[model samples]
Target: MAHAFDGKVAAITGAASGIGLATTEALIAAGARVVLVDRDSKALDAVCARLGANAIPLVIDLLDPASCNTLLDGILSKAGQLDIFHANAGTYIGGDLSETTPETIDRMLNLNVNAVMKNVYTVMPHMIERGTGDIIVTSSVAGHSAIPWEPVYSASKWAMTCFVQTMRRQLNKKGIRVGSVSPGPVISALLADWPEENLRKAKESGSLIEPKEVADGIMFMLSRPRNVTIRDMVILPSNFDI
Candidate 1:
């Protein structure tokens, strides 16, 4: 019962928790050696220990633009080569635009949009040289449709959606596949920014999906045949609404 990703090398950002953590676990279970990238060293170490040898913990603060290059370099230096990459590191900023401070806005955009673009750019040459790889970015339903509550977060995701689409066309011809996983509300730390009332309502209504569900979609995208690319997967709990 061999899996498609068996023995593949994958590097996932924000790999200590939430969607990223879930995806790391899934990849490990599928027999891929995963590099866990996160700023939380303690949590990263804990995860590495929990998952055993297949999980390689790499502590990094991706907010620094230079770290994007460092991340790829470190992975190559340690793991030898990278077969898959998931730009799953991001933050959430809900509430009205006016309520967000300049610093908050900058942080959200840097992590959600800028870092993702830079990460993909930094990894492209390597994947291109190898002429085969898979890149998946974690987007959100808000990316597909503007959500009034979190304007900044929504804008960042929309930008990611565009980036993934354009990068796919740019890289596909070189044997690299690019795609995105856009999920609705999920149980994760990102929801901490949401209004408590809204969060409670979603939970009560069973509208919030679990992080593992989103990870499952990512697994599906990665498992697709080399000749086929799952361009974008918008996974939402059946009862969840925009």
Candidate 2:
């Protein structure tokens, strides 16, 4: 059967593992050509080899702002046009605000916040020129509410949530859609890094969602009609309290 995204081109950041990797698989299955962007060249190459020809792995450090433009150029150079840009690359800083060093804080902000903005900026003009594009970000439920244990991570997601909402309003008339998938407690590298106790509790309770589930939500958002934009979809496990 034919899929809705047949022949579409997508670029996803942090595609080496977790939600990003799951989303890459989902897009490729839907018949879209995907550019899998991640800093881990070895893992990325292995994944691309597994995913086959539909997947193109581009290893670049998103923390370097210039890499954003480089990523855009690479996508255009390879695919000629980009239809979807999933700015789903993010890091989690788990702990009290005081426990985080300035360097750690900077790195988290750069990857989770600054890099997102730069990627959108690099791709927006191209999408605007074409008068069609979709930008889906992977935010967190913590962005919609306070998470005392993850103050820095929450702040970074909140920034992303706001950016997605604002950009939707700014670009809707240009035929571009901006939205986010805010998931709670997915079984990804980020969640695996949580304090051992919390990870164990969530796992024991089956309170963590899978990366593939979040990717499904992203595919639904992308498959929507051009006039229909899912501004935000908050996905959570049924047993999740927050």
Worst 10-residue lDDT window, candidate 1 = 1-10
Clash pairs, candidate 2, are: none
Decoy 1 TM-score against native: 0.98
Candidate 2 lDDT tens digits, 84-159 = 9999999999899898899999999999999998999999999999999999999999999999989999999999
Q: How much is the lDDT of residue 185 in candidate 2?
A: 95
- Model 2's number of clashes is 0
Q: Estimate each model's TM-score.
A: 0.98, 0.98
Off by over 4 Å in 1: none
lDDT of 1: 0.91
- In the order shown, the candidates' Cα RMSDs to the true structure are 1.0, 1.0
RMSD of 2: 1.0
Cα RMSD, model 1: 1.0
